[model samples]
Target: MAYKSRIVQIFIFIITNFFLLLIIDSASSQNILTIESRSDPATPEDCSNRWIHIRNLPSRFNLDLLTNCSDYPLFDDFCPYLANHGLGQKTHIRSRSWYRTDPLLLELIFHRRILEYPCLTDDPDVANAVFLPYYAAIDSLRYLYGPDVNSSFQHGMDLFQFLRSDEPGIWERNMGHDHFLVMARPAWDFSQPLNNDPPVWGTSFLELPEFYNITALVPEGRPWPLQEHAVPYPTSFHPQNLTYFEAWIQRVKRSRRTSLMLFAGGGGIGSAPNIRRSIRNECENGTIKNNISSSSSFNIVQRNGVYSKLCHIVDCSNGICEHDPIRYMKPMLQATFCLQPPGDTPTRRSTFDAITAGCIPVFFEELSAKTQYGWHLPADKFAEFSVFIPKEEVVFKGLRILDVLMGIPRSEVRRMRQSIVELIPRVMYRRHGSSLELRSKKDAFDIAIDGALQTIKDKLGDTLEH
Candidate 1:
């Protein structure tokens, strides 16, 4: 009886020890999971792999420029654009998606969005890229319109000197190859030559050797690719959330496009004079040879029908389109094709606006859209959404813009319009403080940042291999 009791006690002791081990193991696993959950919460989907470190630039570079916004240009009021963190004044539109946005305020918009970026790291050691929050466009504005040509390069020179002296470690790390800045102005605005005989119109900021490796995000990039990249110019529509964005997309998709083509800009504005002038002359005269068919080749009438007006002109010659969204947006929403000729630069902000309204953009220059916005509009799919008519063909050959548009089949037009509708989200700049609930969707700013990071990554990788 004593031996039997001893065996039973031993078995009980063994069972209790085994159960305790299992319990301890389970508790350890729970603790580990808790630590992991606290350490690695969900980040924005687009920022999962990339982290950016925004350099702490001096106030003179950005804030001071905004404080003196009214003093820069005598004719234009920039204070309105400086409002809403560079989103410009909000319009009275019911949806609250549209603003009287100025295209030159992209630096403000980009800076605001990046502040809310999810993967921003305080540690520069771990950052995938660095952003210099210098408002290059605003800085240039001070000297661009001033009389002293030699002082044009002063601000940029001071900026680089400050970067080298104060943030030497960051500047020396890859020699600014991973650093990027946003310039709302065109690339030419900063590329003025110092040795020009009569002193050119722009500043010498881009010509500085310090700017060689830095990537410049501009509205219009140079024709021969360097470090300059073209980003979408800000349009009036800045949706606050995914729901509003989708609603606008649906509205544009369902719009009844009554007019065949639309031109909503002023003529006699840019270096390329003939293109816009020709368009204006053609639109005003309202006469084109009926070249749609061989039977009616000689008849001077609108091609589509006998008495119907095929082209719609908003006539922004009075300069009302710049501040008023209703003037241009309405015509674009009602037209099948929006004409995008070269504006003050090779590109125009109206191109993106037309896309927002789900109107197919008709380009007159290769640099206007094809070469400029490759980051937002894919090169392989350019034909899927836009139409291209060479400026030479239109200026020299007397090509009928209406006949070319009328030749496209109705089915093809519908397909192209649908493609443009799908691209609305990509070309738009989402409101600065909007929620990231729709993590799957990335906007124009998101695309630009991602592209910058990826390009830096590739360049760094190549350096390592070589």
Candidate 2:
């Protein structure tokens, strides 16, 4: 009789547990947010017609602006994102210390399922799969006013919150307004150990997009095609600010007592010795004149009766970029042309510094030409605003780089200086000085800034008082 009782009890327990398991599974399945791709055309006329409010874009906060170039190998037009994976379902978008947004919205690009939630995902295809190109306006004023609002990114808890949900194995494929496949991930954020060594949080994401000027984007680059994938690269054009433009204008107002001043920094890694030699040699030559160069190594060359390296740094933590934020302001305040070259790529901060300091920049890099529509900068409209050394010419024993600087006539040089000067207030020059004079390359950068600014002015353009 006892044995019979034991068997009956086992049967009852098994039945009860089976029913409970079914209930739990059903409850867990309720209302899960699923993300999937939307059927939208690549180019829509209305895309650029409006301004968007970005809470924070991964691209804005992750990539290093000084080192980033549009033509760099990583800048897309070559990444299919999810197609290379052997299994179509295992699409993992890659992000590094440079790109943070790519992993936030991976599911939306696949179109395999629907996003049932209002957030982002860690999957690359799901994160960057679907995003809107928004005219960016960062909240710099808020940060500036707060002074202590160092918000914690908490090891990208914010990103993981949006990209990777809390529960494991519970991913949804859906697109949200914050979906964007950023090219890189920033290692740093406001949260830090406070005693941790370099690589410091947010090196790649140093400047937040919420703190900068961004305008106009379109859908052009997608991660996947319409039928199979949804990850699209951003096709919306963004206009750049003309940092060199204002420098040119500022030069027109300066006195004649100034000599040339050039300060070059960005040491250790990006700072190459030969490139530094090239810059110093040009400045020191009598034929290639420069007033000053802030040197980090060796001495600033003395050419054409001008000084170089009024400032120098062997190694500095914060001091590397501090001294004269404006590359040529102190020297060019009295001089004419600033000896500027492309830093690794033609898109470094030097381009903005020289132009904004009222000094003309001489482009000596092959990449400089690429910045001008990936064609010859001499033939481009920007050619009217800056100077370039023709790549095909040779003036030295064989053909030295310095010879190119000497070969240009004074008349043509003067014209470009003046044109750049006139464009300053309209482009790079800002009354505050914090928001102007940047990569004087991209027409999109220039156009977007102007268009967005004009939009604001249009609101004020009304001859009325609120």
Candidate 3:
């Protein structure tokens, strides 16, 4: 009887230990699951796992342009704009992210950003896209002023040959379909005809058949989209982080707007459109036609008095506005609508500047904003944030621009302004050395990269299906 009792006691001890082990194992698994849940969340739309392989092009393609920056005729001293990895000189104000940025340095800015991209792979075989850090804009500037039009084609041709000979495997993989480069100038600058008498205004770099398959990201793209796609023009304000970005948005929202309209560009210049000259004429002469109602037919309204009360005009005829942000940005910040007329190109950098200031841009041409920046700005939702008046109606039909603006209902104005405020981040370029926290908020650079990658992916998918 004693032996049987001892056996039962041992059996009970073994059963209890087994049950304890089972509970411990189950608790460990639950803890692991909790940790995993905290670490991994749903993937963000802006975030990508696609790998980019940055091409190791010869120095002449990129760095050489910076070394000889002073020789560029466009700027008196172009070297200063080459600082901070193409961010230009810092404003030097404490806690302020303002820079004297050159609008044509997008190539340098993009190169720096891609160098620090998280998904960059050294192996071309594993890369989903190839990034060519070629300073095409700066390179073309040298040829713009020279009498030799044929020389414009040399640099681009050399770049093509180098890629074909050095990286034949990568270049031939998709026939350059997976590769991309940023050209800060307008697409037309690179698409000059080879058969012009006095040498056309731009280079023949983009007209090359070898480059037809390669994607070109430009500040101003062609009217009909092809290999060229539009990207945002660089603005002065580049927030350091998400905190600064959000703060600026709130400040713009809370600030009181005293003026109804603002125009910060040139008027009397030879290149200025008649519509721009007319707007300037109206603003400077303080012409306000009170007899005309919003419902009035498109008839000429005689110039009157006190137009300056509603519209603030910064005559950028002296070219001060481009170098001095305070001259134009302040007016834009204080105005409800910023007039964006077609400048040298169908688009102007001022459109982006207004967007950054949280000022609702009023475009006079469809190519200025609607069709140009579809990658950055929503094409279908233009009405929510912007106002468009056909240049033809304003120039030909004698439509009163001021009266039309004043007629927008206050509620609609508020909603439009609010929409513009929300769009601030989409049009901006974050400062270099931005934290991963800041990068999580997709800015212009991120959007451009994502668009380029998606283009390549779609093309590759189509090829595979065929």
Candidate 4:
């Protein structure tokens, strides 16, 4: 009995000590440096910390932006944020709502700078634009928070619509110009674009088309991928350039990030039965994503497989949601494998988000996983990167999610985490390619913004001479 007790005590001590070391080691991982606004705008609060300014928008937009950027909100005391809604913890008020931005809860938003893309294809328009302010708002947030900061504007909804509408030169007007779409809310109805007050306009500055003159001939440097040919704007790069770059850098920094992986699950706008049926068979039995039924939109029917009780599917539109941090913390932490099947291009945070929470992403092949970011996740490298499932084999073809995970070897799952840890430095960036410390040194955001701003500045430069 004495011997057994001593062994048990030693085990407990080791376990406790292990956790203590983990906490201490992880402390440095949380360092973040926010970009303070150079000029305080005519707004309610200073733009110093996370507080920002919009020319004619309400305080709501600014607050939301701050919330999105921080990923970790410090506004519990300052604003009526928790009460306002969707940061996960909901406080019933005049209406029921799902608050966004719970540290453990990940939500995706599809935003379009619909206004910035009014088809200004003129050569003069593309030359002198300075996209700094626009990018500053975006990249700065991305650095501090994980890819939890997600929005698609450039090549997502705006382009798809322009092409489908076949408006004269619409694609020509916006092609090759790199721009990020910052969004609030999750849909595309032109009327809903505006609320009670000043209209919230989607904004992005135009830059020279990718095919434009470039100093790519820098004697001795990585030959920058030639900007997409005369396509008018940078289409594929919009949604994931930041993370891909960051992941690439993360690999360099951590030397143990995941390498090859894919995230495959969920429909674009919401979970559609058709989508659910289609994705069921991609996996083997007893896998993670398999348990969640893909049959219903925003469907919680299959959630029990992931959760204990059938948690109430709270109404999301009105405001905050029932914040269940405990429910998600373990899931988020243990989910080294997350699935993001193909359906919509605009807002699929479900995929990238899996990356943020330290999960390896498993994707369906329908979307442009690699061509978009030069990221190729082969089976051998699967342990290093995301896993991409081709269209035909998605387990849920009226199949099952459990089968999907079972189909892949447990070795593959562990390999995915290895890839992510290795790629974290390269694919993710706080400043552009800066270290996790949010250092200003060429952050992944800066790399994208700098290339973009250089073009915009040149264009806007002439205009300022007046």
Candidate 5:
């Protein structure tokens, strides 16, 4: 009895010490660097030997841009976008709303994450990649919508001036090939051609010769890839920890699926109708039956004065969606397949949101899912998890989307749902809530950073040792 008691006491001591060591180690790491605005400029020695060196561009590049949120008349429309960060002031948490239609929040969230990333170093010397945290999409929103071409061009112009300056000496560092930028908008928005054609919507920042080598991380990349890499758009479901993610996955797996398929978007119209037009027609024609019904007309005019139709959006005319995030997610959870037609661009964040809800996505365009998320999603598992019916077959040939989805076996659908559930962790970003201190093995941010590093290594061809 004495011997056993002593052994138990020793075991307790060792366990307690192990946790104590962990706490001390965590404290030491926190003390290593403070993630805040700094005045010090990055030197050659600071970047020469780091894995990732974030350029300490003036606050104007990020926060200052958001400082004039009041200037925009639709400032109240930005509550959800600014809830996580202080868009201007820390507003009250009125409701659990996830009306993230405008992807400007993606850049804001990413900026917060990279600052807190463990790989982030104060020194620039040992860096394999340089991150230029610029909120180009957010800044140009007003100009893109208005007739202020010079105002829209001003943000890009300022970025160019800073990049070309001798202060940071970023020009000499790998000729900007190793440098990367993240824009929440589609690639086309930044690369509007300066030809004799009618003016484009977005800033022509990307068309500049100086930016040719820079890696662009965007929500939608063009088919013929230059440097633009498609990253997942910000979805409403930001789990605070792995437990919430795992619980949601289990809930989705066991939940009763009463619907065969669901489409949570509005109808479209016009001469050059997108795939959504066919989807709306099919739904109205009783070809596709939605478990939950919504009705509206969202007219979205694209660049060059073309009318693009959109729907399934909660009324944003009042600046905010009245519905809760769960309302958007419930249909997806109850359905076997979620219809994912392009929205404004070829890719929508709904594709990722469907994956999170454990629903198999039926993509109209291959680039919507197949080519976009190469970093986190496995190429081989595309067929195993998703369904792709080309837009031509749907719109031109009058292909029946419901017939194709119903043809897929129940067992196959179950397998695909399980596959999607398994991908929940990799695709979702962890929220900086209570579990911010508790680390995840890896998440979307880590996957993107690792992908960026590997891509640089491949392109540089042995120049980078990291």
Candidate 6:
């Protein structure tokens, strides 16, 4: 009788736990939103109605510059800096960061993707938009980091000469208004220098008159600019297919976020007053300790430009500071929020990584999210997904990072995390060397291409008419 009673109790406990897990899974699934790929059928009409890519441009200006030009192989000389169609060296087979794409290599990725696009045409007569397909970023990098900084301007000059001398009629076509160029770096890198301003380290690609009419799809577009469109900075998170992306979303959504927030970068010097340093200082000052218990996991990494020291003052693991994608993402996945201070410029690629990890980003500057309306993020949805505190208040003033974050209600934080998880696909670069063949699955590259084509159609109006 006693043995039978014990068996019955065990069965009941198993049934109760199983039902509870099902309920939890169902709740999480409710929050997971999948972006449906558009059902637009592929046809000759689709191809002809889309953008026309220019085939006459010098190969040296783009592909050869990436292939033969060997400058930035600090990791491995054999592996080209512009490998895997500008997605960089594949770092992992399962993770998109396996390729380890350089942040400034988006131009190479964009050019290749555009060439492989289903809408690409052999003739320009039946096209809506013209893509220049220039690797100006790579060319600039070769010169910028080289011994002669002034030589960077020559690449821009050479490109201008090619456009004027060889393709004069191409410029006359819509006066270059229907054309566009994709850049991997920030717009400031290629800005035209002012008369008395300190020397900046980029080519005057934006200053050239021929390029004035062209739309620039840059990682960081200047605010209040109409011609420049902000694209996602290349992040470490890359999903191979729809399955990988969906799996990641489900996994991150279900992660146990024990930490209030994390700061994964080093201190800054200019623009904003080293906000990361301020946050680190505040954490040490017992401000956060007074709010959360001593058992909390507030992991902070003291990173110099090269080496990083994981100051595991709390009960954090060694995996917190590992450079590998899984280890790097682990902390983010476990945190409620990720600190995103401006690095060199106002924008950081980690901002997108935070979104990809389903962690709400705490940004210091407005331009970090505000200027990026054209490609990845929606204009009006900033407040719904992220937390923004002005730099002056956070850094200059003695405001505590923990106090500000801990003040948000748990329900609101959950809502924000769900919103961020929904946005993962928008900011991720598709796995490189994947099938270019037509498929229903659409990734970040496909979305950007679609958006660009639509913008061109809207701008050209009757020009694309039959």
State the lDDT of candidate 1 residue by residue for 278-325, as single tens digits: 787667654445535543442433354432457788878756788678
User: What's the lDDT of the predicted structure labeled candidate 6?
Assistant: 0.64
Best-fitting candidate, measured by TM-score? 1
- lDDT by residue (1-466, candidate 3, tens digit) is 9778656545543453354234323322322222211222333332354777788776678765665665656545465566566676666657367888888788888876665565655678878999887889888877885445457665488888999999699999998989999999999999876656566678988888899888899999988767899999999888877788888888788766777789888754455447787677656654345665533322222133212247788888856777678778777888889999886778999999998888889999899989988888999999999999887887778876787887788899999998998788788999866755777788899899889999888878877898
TM-score for each predicted model, relative to the true structure: 0.85, 0.38, 0.84, 0.37, 0.77, 0.77
TM-score of model number 1? 0.85
Which residue segments of model 4 deviate by more than 4 Å?
1-129, 132-273, 277-329, 343-347, 368-383, 395-404, 407-412, 425-437, 440-444, 450-466
**Weakest ten-residue segment in model 2 by summed lDDT:** 228-237
Report how far residue 400 has shifted in candidate 3, in Å.
0.9
- Residue 465, model 2, lDDT: 50
Cα lDDT tens digits, model 2, 274-355, are: 4444444444542432434434222433443433432222222343332223333445455455544444334333444455
List per-prediction Cα lDDT, in the order shown.
0.77, 0.32, 0.76, 0.31, 0.64, 0.64
Candidate 4, residues 315-405, lDDT tens digits: the string is: 2222232132223323434444555554434224344344544666655552334433322122345435665555454433444444444
Question: Ten residues in a row with the worst lDDT in model 5?
Answer: 296-305
The better-scoring model by lDDT among 3 and 4 is 3
Q: Which ten residues in a row have the lowest lDDT in candidate 4?
A: 229-238
TM-score of 6: 0.77
lDDT of 5 by residue, 1-466 (tens): 9778656545543453354234323323533244332223355564343367677666567665664443565333443245444221212254222333345667766766665555555445556788887887777766675436644444477787887784455556677878887888888888776552556577777777778777888888888878888888766665555566567777888866655566665445555656877876666563323333323111111232321322122222232322244555776777777888876677877788788888788888887868888888877789888898998998899787866875677788878887888787787666543254324456777688778877776666645653
Instruction: Write candidate 6's Cα lDDT for 1-466 as tens digits.
Output: 9778656545543453354234323322321111122233357866656756553676667655644344554322222334454555456554444556566668766765554455655455666777877777777766566554655445477776777688576667677777788887788777755331444677677766656767778888777665678788877666555666667788888987766677776553235456766766655553344444543423331221211221212212332332245545777777778877776688877788788888898888888876574467776788889998887887777776777776788789889988998788778777644433323466677777777777777766745562
Which candidate model has the greater TM-score, 3 or 4? 3
